[model samples]
Target chain A: MPTITVDGRRLEVPEGSTLLQALDELGLLMNGVDVPHYCWHPKLSVDGSCRLCQVEIEGVPKLQIACDTPVADGMVVHTTSERVQRAREGVMELLLVNHPLDCPICDQAGECKLQDYAVDYGLDHARTREPRRPGRKRVELGPTIVFDEERCILCRRCVRFCREVPETGELVVENRGDRSRITTFPGTPLDNPYSMNVADVCPVGALTTRDFRFKVRVWDLDEVPGLCTGCSKGCNVHVGVARGAVQRYTPRRNDQVNETWICDEGRLSYREIGAPDRITRPAVRDAEGRMQPVSIARAIERAAERIRAAVLREGPAVVAALASPHATNEDLTELRRLLDGIGTATSGAAVVEGEPDGLLLQAERAGNARGARDLGFGDPGLVFEKIRGGGVRVLLVMGRDLLAEPFLGGTDPLASLDAVILLDTHRSALEQVADVVIPGRMLAEKGGSMTNHAGLVQRVPAALEPAFDAHAEGAVLARLRAALELVLPARSEGAA
Target chain B: MVSTLVAQAPEATVLSDELRAAIDREIARFPEPRGALLAALRLVQDELGCIAPPTARAVAEIFGLHPAEVLEVLSFYNLFHTEPQGRHEVRVCTNLACSLRGARTLLRELEEHLGIRAGQTTPDGRVTLGHEECLGACGYAPMLRIGDRYHEELDGPAARALVDGLP
Candidate 1:
């Protein structure tokens, strides 16, 4: 351990720690002193190119870049000294010399590092009367990314990220000096699986995601920590909401799952959260054989009544529950409780399994398949055969859209049921045939825990209200259980 | 419900056989294929006069590196050109010592004589005039390099003669 004094506060940091890391450990980043930086990311290799993290050290002849200087025993570093501030200001001046002043029209204006540092470390006005360098604007780096050359300070964070993290070196610095800019090799644009992450790591408005370029400003959007339900990988994410709409989904840093990155699939998967076709209210078929929106209480009462009548007439074996693996553990557990009370067999929860890409994407496309299986939703292969054989009467389908899935192999198996109760968030083709529908919440509109494929149970919080007065799956299930006078068994302590 | 579309894989046979063989030989000499990048690029540039974006991509595939990495290395150096160069290259020194000794006047004369400014090649692709910081011959003052050889102590007429004599 090396004992160091930053400003006037003394602290002991581990050996081999850089002065930047030591300051970070001392909580001095946002407290009293701030070291401005561009190329020095906590997850990336230190390039020491930005020259913005310079600090004065006692007994040292010159100021040193805190990111590259290793902590030495008895070292005294001053991050807020007048000399250090002047050197930092000088670096800030040079960085802004060629950088475009279009923050008002830039997408990353509110969250830009250059804008943040300019408030404290920047010179009030430019000293030179020379014109700013004009550059190629809105260059499509790939399908999902746009590059603005004039805004780039050449931090190389995106370059290092491509080489070191995803290891797809598609992006490169082309040319030299002032003419230098980031570009992809001819015919091979930055089309990697993790290419959008470049926009997230860019400190300025140089790189921006095409989907979110002019959608909403960062400050106007509300960032809510959430989990990606794209697959069993459960990559941690932040839900960006504005005006009761999902603007974007950015990866939240979680070292155990996705470390500062969510795959392109997960990142762009936020499009379906508040889609136009989302199921917003409870509906049931009227006497004219057409489905019409109804009250939640009436829909739940009719569903329970139909299920009870089917059980009494055809026996419990004819009424099967087909829940989805996409349901949260709490939702699934409540679903199992209701099914047990009715004395019927469950078709079991299973989702379409895709091959894992060996990165963050999992083979199981279901977000909570592990939790559903842990809640005793076993193999549904046998139940599907029984349903196709016309032995089942009343079927309650939870999140999965059977008519949409090719799993039934061109056969409309759910069509044979006399009464079908579909509880889902999105409107699928099956809604045309189902007898009753309950508008359930999407994962983004619910607060529950899900077990990943690795058996890691993580909390998924509600970022926004349910669409069209849709209730959370848990709340909906709990209400249905209450209507049926079914009591859930108490969960044991520390149980999954 | 977002779609996951995978990018098409780069073609397997983008490089010429001779270039591939040369890159393979360079790779065999180094412990890691990446260690041969600079040498392989240099060899390609020497044969083609410049490395285009497609050529850089082919070289990157050969070395199992990102074309961006190859481009980063290629762009950092002034010697490497990404476009076609003139048949005969001329570099005029313009460092502090050379500039103080009227190197700027010599460059202006050469530009007027060739009818093309610095960084531009002659219309017929016979010669290219470029200004470099220093050719490591600052003592020579107003000097120029023709291809790889340096010509020191050159007046405006002498430099014009050197360009005029180029075949």
Candidate 2:
């Protein structure tokens, strides 16, 4: 470890650590005194392009860029010195010369680094009397990203992010001097798996997500640490919510998993939260065979009564449960308990996912396949085969539609079954066939943790009240378990 | 999401046989191939006289760089051209020393004679006229460099004579 004294305090940071990383470890960033920067991101390479991070190192004639400077033992650095302040002022002035000064209309106004640093250390008046350089106001860089040329400070954080992280060198700084702007190849667009991360890395309003452009201000968003349920990777994210709905999902830094970057698919999965067809009320097939809405208590009671009738008619072996990999571990635990209480066999959870890109996107769709298995969910093929073989009559689907599964030999798998009790978060084809349809909650409606494919358990806090805030899947399972225990005495050895 | 959209892959390289051999030699010189991007770009410019989009992609294939990076560096230097320009490019030194003498007046005369502005090529595409910051020949004021050679100590008649001589 090398010891360095900065602005007065002395701290020993790990060896081979850059001065910026060392200083950040000292807890000086956004603390009492801050070293303003634009291009120097924690996860990216040290680019000394942005000279605003210059600090006065003792015995060095010129101010050194702290980002590229290695922290040596007994080094004395002054960030608040007169020389450092003047350097920052000069750099900020030159950077603001061609700037469009559109913070009033810019979406990145409140959280923008340029806006923050200008107020802290920049000069109010611009010395240049020349006209500001005009540029394209709304340049569509890709399907998801929008580029504003005038607002760009040429920090190159987004460019480096594309180069270093995803290794997709699509974004490049075109031209030089005042004419420089970030662009992709002539025909190729910035449509990489981790492309939206550029919007987060961009220090200015130059790069913004097309999905979030002019939608909701940053301050208006109520952010909470959450995990993305788009895949089994369970990428840690900050759920940005407004008006009781998820506005966006920004990846939060987790050294173990997603390092401050999320896949575009996972980031866009927040759109499904407020999408139509979300189940808001419990429903049951009435005497006329039409699904009718009912209260949560009535739905659970009716579902339990149907399950009991099936167990009474034949036995517990007649029923089979298919768990959803998308459900949280907490809900899986309750489902497992409820199935154990009913003494029925489980067909296991469906894998239903796309091919893995070998990066963050896992093949098991969404969250908690490993946890479902840990709770002893068997193979789904067995359930499908059993349902196809006409050996099973009463079917219990938890948070998934297994009838539509190809493995279930989709010859009306519900036709042979007498009753189908489904716990779903959305109105699906299963609703038309299921005898009892109890409403379940989405990832955003409940607080729970799920084990990722890597076995790292990440807790996700509910960011918004779901469109249907009726009952969580766990509560529904708990009620069903209680109702089953009250009626059946844990049917033994397939006894009728 | 954005990743779901299809991105057009770059076409097969259109680098010439001789240019490919030259780029390979340039790549062998550097410890890493990407380090020869600048040198490879220079060779492309010398061979093609300009770095067009397709030529840039060809060079990028050799250097393993994004074509946009080559375009980024291509725009930084005045020596390298990206688009098809005049047959003979003329740069009039209008720095402090050249302007103090008579470089601006000489440039105006040449523009009038050629019927084109300082930064534009003639209608016939014979010559491109532009003003440079400094040619490092400040000692010899009022100088204009055309093609590969520099003509120093020039007046309005001398500059016009040189332009008129260009066929």
Candidate 3:
């Protein structure tokens, strides 16, 4: 470690750390200097073309770009110095000279680094009489990215990103001077599994995602730390919410998992948030075979009464629960207690097989398959077969509609069951057929910890309030346990 | 204001035996494979007449680099044409010394004779003409380069003779 003094504060940074990283570590990087960077993404290789991170080192002859300058022992650096400020102003002035000034229509207006730095360092108006440089706008660089050349500052952040990460190298700086723009390979779409990360690496308004470009303004979003539940990788994410729905999911920096990057598959999974088929209210089948909406309390009480009657008639062997591999640890634990309380140890989470992508995506698609395994659950496929063989008469489903699986799809898996209790976030094929369908909160509307396939537990906070009359799956399970114990005098609370 | 790239990818190209051997020789000279990219690309351009996307892919395959990486280098330099190079390349200097000595007029005359403008290939595909900023023969004002040879101390007639002299 080398000791360096930045802006009058002395601190020891790790050896081989750059001045910018050292300043960032010391917390001395602030004030009118603003962000003072464009091309230096923490994850990508540094291309110091922006020249805005200029700092006045005491021994250096010229203002050195902080991102490219290595820190030395006893080196004194000044980031808020007059020379550094003037350099930043000059850089900002030159950067804005050829800008289209279309911030009003730009999707990156609010959160753009160019916009942020321009506020503190830019001139009131352009000084040059020459017209703004003519460059192409709305260039579809690839299937996922839209390129606006004029907005680019020749920073090469996105170019470096494609070259380094994903190792695709699809994007390149075409031409030279003012005509330079990010161009893809002669003919290839930017559909690499992680191509959307380029838009996240771009600090300016140049590259914007086709999916989120005009859908929602960034400032309107309420960010909550969450995880991508598409797989057991548990890549941490910032769940962007607006109008009570998930607007987008951007990668959150979790070095243990996804390092400031998420796969395009997980990024676009936000589109499934408020699908039309989502279950909004709990429903119970009427005598006429129609699913009629019922109060949540009434639905739970009716569910308990039906289960008690089945337990008293067919004994505990007639009942088995199908647990969700996607549920949180708290919910899985509660589900375990509920299944045990009923004296039926028969349970299994349905297992689906797929090859792992060797990146953030894992072989296990469920977010908490490891949690389910650790909490003591079995194969849900076996539970369905048991129901078909007349061993189990009643089935309680957590989220997966195992009865709808192909093996049981032809014949009604619910035919042998006297009652079916389904708690699901989305409407399924078995919804109308199930005896009771309880509306459950979506993963984005529930808060708990989930252990990934690697057993790394991460907190998944609710970004939006539970939609309609839904409850957290854990809350429903706890209430169901309370309801079941009321009749089973032999089974007291916490006795299971 | 919408744009999109094709979902389909361009096919990769295979390198010729001699070009592959030359590329290996170039790669051996440098510590890293990428260091030989420029030399390898020039060799490919020489062999294939131009470093088009296919040839670029071929060179990239040899250098273990992305095709776009090779294409970017080709795009940055004015000499590495991406299109099939004409049988002959005619370049007239349009720098300060050359332009002052009637180089622009000579270039226009040549364009008219060749039936094409600077930076364009003739319809017959016999010659490609362009103006350079400097050809490094400033003493011979308004000097023009034809292939590897420089035609210097020239006027309209001699320049025409030199251009017509292309076999």
Candidate 4:
């Protein structure tokens, strides 16, 4: 272990650790003691080209880059000295020489590091009156990202990320000196699954997400901790919500899961959560056999009445419930308890399978399929057979649509059921045939815990209220359980 | 407002057998195949006059490396040219020491004699003129390196005579 003092506070770090790592271990990086930097990402390799992490050592005459300099025993460092401050201000001036002042319309303005440091380091005004060199304004790098050449400071964080982490090596720094810019080869576009992560790593407003461009500003939105429901990988993310709708999903740091990088599919999957075609209110079958909007209390009463009548006519074996792997553990647990109370414990979970890219994505597209299995849900293959064989007359669908899967051969299973009750956030193919449709909250609006494929339990909090009159699956299930107790007092008493 | 440099198509292979064998021999000298990229690129440029995008792509494919990585290395160093080369390339030293010794005047004289700017080649495809920061030849002040040979202590008339003498 080597002991080094940062501004008179001494600490010991593991041998061969750089000074930047020591500052991070001492909790002086990006908080408490601020060292301005652009190219020094903890997850990426050391690129000392930015020259912003310069710090003055006790004995060394020149300022050393804290990212590349290894800590020595009995070394004294001063990061806030007058010399260090002057060096950082000089570097900031050079970086801003070619960078544009389009912060008002730039999507990364609010959360951009260069904007924050410009205000922090007192370089908010330009010293040179020379006209800034102009370059390309908006270059579509790929399907997910857009590149702005004029606003780039050329820190090369995105280039390093492609070459180091994902190792795709598609992005490169072309031209030399003042004409240098980040670009891909002519034919090879930046089409990797992890390409959008470059937007997150950019310190300036150079690279921005195409989906989130001009949608909403970061200051107006509230970032709430959430998980991406795209797959069983359970990548941690921050849901940016504004005005009761989700705007975007950005990755959060979780070394055990995604490690500060999320796939482009997971980031864009929030579109389904805030899509305009979502089922916003509960609906029930009316006199003309059309689904009409109804109050929550009325919808639950009608569903309970039909379920109890089916149980009385054909035994509990005819009534079955199908749970979705997308639901949280608490939601699935409540659904299982309700089905057991009604004497139809033949319920299983729905699983969607695809090819895993061997990176962040998993083959099982459901977020909580493992959670469903842990709660003793039956296999999806067996449940599909029970529905097709007509063994189940009355069915409760929780957060899944059976008609959406191609294994059913384009057949609508809800057409054969006597009464079909559905609980989903989005409008599905089975909506026309369902006897009762109840709008439920998506993953961004849920307040519960979900177990990932590795059995790691993480909390997913509600960022905003449900889109319309919708409620969480757990909340709706609890309300339905209360409504059923009144209709079937004898069966409820035995289960209780 | 977007601009991109055209990379050569990966499907094209423009290297001859002799050049490919030379590249393979250089690559076999190092434990890591990528360590011989500079030498392999030099071999291609020496035989083909310049390392075009297609030639770089072929070399990258032979070494099992990404073409972009090879292009990055090609564009980074000033020694390697990624475009078609002139029959004769002239680089004039223009650092502080050489400039003080009247190297800039010599460069201007050579550009005027060749009927082209510093970075442009002649219309007759005879000579290309370029200015370099330093060639580590301060002892040989007012120096110009033509094709691999350096001419020292040159005046305006001498610099013109040197370019006019090139066939």
Best by DockQ: 2
Q: Per-residue lDDT of A1-496 in model 2, one digit per residue for the tens?
A: 7788988988888799988887676666657657889999988988889899999999999999989998899999999988899999999998898999998899998889999889978888888899999999998888889999999988899888877777777888877777788888787788787889999999999999998999998999999888888888889988998888999999998868887789899999988778787777788889999989888788888888888888888878887888888888899888888777787764698766678876789888858888778778846888777887888877878765354445453436676678888888777777767888887777877879898988988787777777555677888889888878876955433445
Instruction: Put the candidates in lDDT order, highest first.
Output: 4, 1, 2, 3
lDDT of 3 by residue, B84-131 (tens): 867889999999999999999999999888788898887778888998
Q: Considering only chain B, report the TM-score of model 1.
A: 0.89
Where does the lowest 10-residue lDDT sum fall in candidate 2 chain A? A402-411
Model 1 C-alpha lDDT per residue in residues A1-496, reported as the tens digit of each score: 8898888878888789898877766667656567888999877889999999999999999999999999999999888899998998899999999878998898889998999999888988999789999999889998989999999999999988777776766777888788888888777788888889999999999999998989887898889988888899888999999989888999998878887888888899898887888888899999899998999999998887777677667767787876787888889888988877666665687577777877788988888888888988867776788888988888888876344354564337777788888899787766876899998877788868888999999997788985477887777777877776532222111123
Q: What residue pairs clash in candidate 3, if any at all? A: A348-A378
Candidate 4 residue pairs in backbone clash? none
- How does model 1 score on DockQ? 0.41
How is the predicted docking of candidate 1 categorized under the CAPRI scheme?
A: acceptable
B27-81: candidate 2 lDDT, tens digit per residue: 8998988888888888888777788888888777666677777777877787888
Q: Please say which candidate is ahead in DockQ: 2 or 3.
A: 2
Candidate 2, A48: how far from true, in Å?
A: 1.0
Candidate 3 recovers what fraction of true contacts?
Answer: 0.45
Interface-residue RMSD per candidate?
A: 6.4, 5.6, 9.5, 10.5
TM-score of 3: 0.93
**C-alpha TM-scores of all predictions:** 0.91, 0.94, 0.93, 0.92
User: How many pairs of residues collide in model 2?
Assistant: 1
Residue A26 displacement (Å), model 4: 5.6
DockQ versus reference, model 3: 0.37
Could you tell me which 10 consecutive residues in candidate 3 chain A have the lowest summed lDDT?
Answer: A401-410
Best by lDDT: 4
In order, the first chain's TM-score in every candidate is 0.92, 0.94, 0.93, 0.94
